[model samples]
Target chain A: MENIILTSSPTTPYFPEVSFDIDKGICEIRGESYMEETYKFYLPLINWIKDYIKLIKKPLVLDIKLIYLNTSSTKCVLDILEILKDYEDDSGQVKVNWYYDKSDPDMIDEVEDFEAESGIKIELKEF
Target chain B: MTSKTILSYKGPFYIELISVFGTNIRNFNDTYSNARKKLFKIFIELSQNVSNYSENFHMVNNVQRIGVGELFLKELDTAYCFTTINQVKRTDAEILAERCEIVNASDQMKLRELKREQRLNSPGEKFGARIGLIQAVMLSKNQLEYKVENINENFSYFSLTVKIDKY
Candidate 1:
């Protein structure tokens, strides 16, 4: 499968930067994500993971460095983590590292909530 | 309690305006303020709540529905009050008030749980308001303050305010 990349731009600040590399098994979503059409943006990322698991069967590392996420986009993040959790449960190798600004404690709480909801071990990194 | 007004706007809450307002709110807060994170989150959730569900809305190019509302950011002695007001059907106002009551009654943990439960659903016309309220309470660690002012038999002005404590 081909890789996907969406760079964040100041002109369109509603969406975040998304990079899903199929070969390297490293995917990253950074910046703020509160797009009005959240599903249109996130569903394909979900489907890409499904395809990677089915076709490549390789280890995956997901990096999330989001500062702001609306509730709807928050759900999409959970969905992505759920897919990873399922992959890990099936004896596949996957790891998630979430980066946050040191000044923001709420992101820490949010990552904790994601862990509680998806039952995935997400390492927190401060930037 | 008296509050110092920081910013205020009244008009259609279209997508472009929301983005501009969101950035303006962020720029208004200090980079080192511990309250910045919660303040921004509450601002986005509540404004988006109005932009999505407020009854008085206009169609943009006959495709997009942009809600008309007023948003205010005010500084209290110990907190920042982020509020939005908009016209809503009388029926929807009751629903909004009930949701506020539910959110205010829940503590942080419960609010988080409620937010998660409501957030699992997909995004659409039904996705924003309830979950946004829960997230606002969860982020701010404060009870929601709201009002429903009757404008007519079928419509009322719904105002929702949340306080983010400044540390």
Candidate 2:
């Protein structure tokens, strides 16, 4: 599968920078995410992940370092995590790491919520 | 709470304008830095609610879809209040009221649960408003106060308010 790479901006509809390498099995989602058309932006990344798990079956590392994400974007993130969780449950080599602002308690809670909802072990790294 | 209006605007909430508003709010009152992020988050949630779900929208140069609404930020001694108003269909008003009830009745933990439930309901906004409502309340840590002003037989103005207490 081709890698998905997109850069974010200092503007509205803050689409996060994404780099999903199918070969390397390293997917990193960074920056802010708050756009009106959230599904359109995330569906491909979600699909890329699914296809990787189904086809590649390599060691997958998903790095998420988003600073600000709206509720809609949050749902899409959870969906991505759920897909990874499934792959991990099946004894696939998968790891999820979330880097966050240590000073921002809200984001910490958000990362925890992602863990609780998806039943995934998201390693939290302080930024 | 004794508060005065720190910022106010009324017009079509295009994405560009929303970006400017966010920057201004982030730098609104540096003394309230603790509340800036929460304020910014709640503001984005509420304003996006207007830009996305307001029943009434117009075209910009026949190229862009613009949702018209009003936003106001009030600064008090202990908290900051944000209010938004937009036109909506009567049917939407009913749904908004129901969603508000769900958000208002829930505590922080329950609100978080509700948010997750609603989020899983749809990846395409079948329950988008529900998620946004729950999130605004959760981030603000305040009640979702609302009022419906009747405009005509089929439309009404939906006003929503949330307060972010200063830390």
Candidate 3:
């Protein structure tokens, strides 16, 4: 029920800043995710989304503006998208947007692939 | 050692080492921003693979921990080559060699499709779909070259190399 807000740290740029507002139905994950133990970091966020979709029953908007994310974190992102996909399947309103650096084609390809694989429409924007 | 050698680290592949090496590479003057991102991404994926799966380990403070490996970055005329060497069980070496071969032969589209398939089918596996190799190949935008050398009956040394063109 409480919103999760984590400030960004320069020392461990791998861990991103996560802001999930329970009331606003807006979740934003920004920064590089290169955590050594990725599973431990992502499980809670995944559970939180599941809780929001089930308990809040409100429209959700997920915004991701990440500079870098490793393969494990990529898997986590996919897990999050899969959750959103399932929510949409159940007639729950869900929207996802990925803001990627225009210079990084790899990031763009990744977002497109995620959209294709998850069967969830992700609005891709370049900035 | 070649005069083109930019940097090299040989020893236990700790988790934090990846970020340290990445930061240094990012600060290199010759590396363009896009290329630097790709370089760092490939470096982390390859190095972490060594950290997570390398079979060789050294005991520290009465605890057996993940083993050691070597990472080297060398400059060429127009590209920078990143290479990692680590110890693996024979079975893992065989699996990794086969995966590298598969990745080496695929074009970008095929690689993308393969990554998507792996992500969808095995997303929750301990290593999260084991897509590290594919991601490295995608970011490096080059073929993966690897060699598996017999170290002993039980283990073999696996070396993987990816080259990123410096622009």
Q: All candidates: CA RMSD in angstroms?
A: 2.1, 2.0, 2.0
Error of 1 at B128 (Å): 5.0
DockQ ranking, high to low: 3, 1, 2
Interface RMSD of each: 2.7, 2.4, 1.6
Model 3, residue A11: distance off in Å is 1.5
- Candidate of highest DockQ: 3
**How many pairs in model 2 have backbone atoms within 3 A of each other, for residues 3 or more apart or on separate chains, i.e. clashes?**
0
Per-residue CA lDDT of candidate 2, range A1-127, in tens? 6888887666644778989987778999888887777777888988898999889889999999888898888878888888888888999988899999876789988888889889999999998
Task: Write down the worst ten-residue block by lDDT for model 1 chain B.
Answer: B121-130
User: Which tens-of-lDDT digit does each residue in A1-127 have in candidate 1?
Assistant: 8899999888778889989998789999989987776777888899999999999999999999888888878878888899999999999999999999987778888898899889999999987
Worst 10 residues of 1 chain A by lDDT: A34-43
Query: Candidate 2 chain B TM?
Result: 0.91
- For model 2, residues B1-167, the per-residue Cα lDDT tens digits are 57789889998888778777887888756676758888888888889889887778878789667789999999899988999999999888998998899889989989878876776666453334247778788888889899999899999999999989988
Per-residue CA lDDT of model 3 for A16-127, tens digit only, reads 9999999889999998888766877888899999999889999999999998888888888898998999999999999999998887888888888888878899999876
Q: Ten consecutive residues with minimal summed lDDT in candidate 2 chain A? A: A7-16
- For model 3 chain B, the run of ten residues with the poorest summed lDDT: B120-129
Q: Tens digit of lDDT per residue, candidate 1, span B45-124?
A: 77877787788888889988888899998887887888899999999888888888988888887887786677665453
lDDT of 2 at A22: 78
Clashing pairs in 3: none
Which structure among the candidates has the greatest lDDT? Answer: 3
